[model samples]
Target chain A: MSAEVFEPYQVFVRRDALDAMEHVGTVMAASPEMAVLVARQNFLRRDAAVGLWVVADADMHSANTDPQFFAEELDKSYRRVDGYSDNARRWKRFKQQALQLQDIVRDLESKEG
Target chain B: MAQDDKAARGPSVAEGAALVDLLLQMADDDLVLGHRHSEWLGVAPDIEEDVAFSSIAQDEVGHAALYYELASQLGAGDADRLAFDRPVGERRSAAFVELENGDWARTAMRHFLYDAFEEVRLDACTRSGWQPLQRAATKVRREEFYHRLHSRTQLHHLAKAGGEAFARLEHALADLWPYVASLFDLGPHAAELRATGVLPADAAALRSAWEAVVVPELSELGFGVPACGGTDATSAAHRGAHHPALAELLTTMRAVLDVDAAAASW
Candidate 1:
């Protein structure tokens, strides 16, 4: 069969249940069923995946086509994951305070006994 | 004797040889067909299919190695020697897997039929009286689950496409059916294997179980099931008598070893 009859699909794989489906690559297949089967070997040969999705290229839309779509109109740092980078330090401080409180409570209990 | 006691003690000397024979059959079929499937590596219909065939081929060889390891433990020989050094007459692979991969249609047809038969065979092995074979069968069956899925999906898509695809698959089924029955031939140890519960079913029972699965599905796909019988190449008596192609295939397989007899472990 000629390659023209096949359609392009964007392949995505989830390595585990908690993992997000990451786009691995594109594959050409005659149907969705074939696409999934093909995408499996193409993307998951070395790694066992818990999930896979193949979306038709025609069904996909992206803002990358227009460079202006990604141009920042204002600071949108809050919309990205890096905005919460200080959460690790904050959680560590909170945990230390909580542990101190627990020690004080234990001291009070021992004195009462 | 109870099945547990039998498994605990393992096979008698005769039964050990029979077990080795059975393992060789399974291993040789996988190794041979895996080589055939590997032939499509760069020449498959498309890049995706190339990847699929390559992965499936690797899985088949891996399964073959698993069986060979079991056979080696039973004192058949070194696993590598058992796989690569055996004489053609000693090989127990059926005519179905030994034949050439004529076309994509024939390859797909044989793959579908063979996987279906393998599933039934493995299902029986899962209950084997020999603990090692049972455990190995369980692991192999888990991998085969995806193989059946891939084969059935391909078969369904091609048959449903109708016209050229459907006709090609139909023709392939007709061409392969006579030899496909050879897959169920359990060789000379069928009676003892069954009696010992090493194999829970004999050839006829396994064949019926296999048909019970594939017949309805293939019929629904609009392909006619050809009459089942044995050809000279595919008789139960000639199960170990391999196709001539096997020697050619083995030559190619042994190319690396031929060059360096003491090649480092693969």
Candidate 2:
């Protein structure tokens, strides 16, 4: 039979229920059923995996391979939690002021007593 | 008797010998077939299948090692010696496993037949009165789930493909069918093993169960099911006699081990 008889299927594995499925590898099989079997045999031999997914290579669509597809023209740090570093600093200052106010209240209470 | 009673008392002299025989048969089958499957490492039709077969082969060999360890506890010698040093005539593996890994069709068909039988055999073993054997059988059966899936998927694919693929599978079935019965041959200790509850059933009963499962599936796929008889004479040849193919296979399998008499490890 010609090599074309087999189609490539991408394999994905999830280690646990809470984990996202990650790409493992590709396996060549004649049909989707065979693909899943082959994917399990090839990829799940050693590791513990709670989930597996096999997608036909033909069925997958991807963005252009050009670096421009992933390039960020402007800083997008604000989109990430690390960009809110000032919030962490402000929270620490707020905690310190609250502690000082508590101390002041305690001192007034002691003087009154 | 309960499995707990058998475990407490251990085996009698007769039962111990019978257990050794059973373990040898199980180990030999896996060792020979594992070697055969490992031969497909780089030569399989596709890279994915190559990896799959390799993993299956490793599991089979690992199973053989487990059986051999159990046999050693029963006075069957060390695992390595039992695996590599035994003469061909002494091996208990059925002939089906010793047959060449012909074309992909034959390989797939043989795998389906052998794995199906093995699945049944191991399932039965899970209930063995011998606790160690039962535990080992249970552990190995987990890995066998994938093997059964692989062989079944490939066999169905070949059967349904039609044209050359189907024809090739048919031809392979005709060639392999006669040897299928020999896989169930449990050797001279069969009765003793069964009576002692070391084996749940005799070869005939296991073979019938195997056929019950295998025949209808093949028929549904439009393939002719080979008629079952008593033990296959051809496979019987390998039960106590040496087939040339087995000798050749053993030579290759032992080549590295034979190279050094004093080597500490493989």
- How many clashes in each candidate? 0, 0
Which candidate wins on lDDT? 1
- In the order shown, the candidates' DockQ scores are 0.63, 0.58
How do all models score by TM-score?
Answer: 0.86, 0.89
In DockQ, how does model 1 score against the reference complex? 0.63
Clashing pairs in 2: none
Per-residue accuracy of model 2 over B169-243 as CA lDDT, tens digit each:
999999888777567778899988888788988887887888888989999999977667743566344366535
Instruction: Output the lDDT of residue B72, model 1.
Output: 92
What is the lDDT of every predicted structure here?
Answer: 0.88, 0.87
Candidate 2 chain B, run of 10 with poorest lDDT: B230-239
Q: Candidate 1: give its CA RMSD in angstroms.
A: 7.1
Tens-digit lDDT track of model 1 for B68-108: 99899888889999888887888889888988899999999
Instruction: Output per-candidate TM-scores for chain A, rounded to 2 decimals.
Output: 0.61, 0.68
By TM-score, who's the top model here? 2
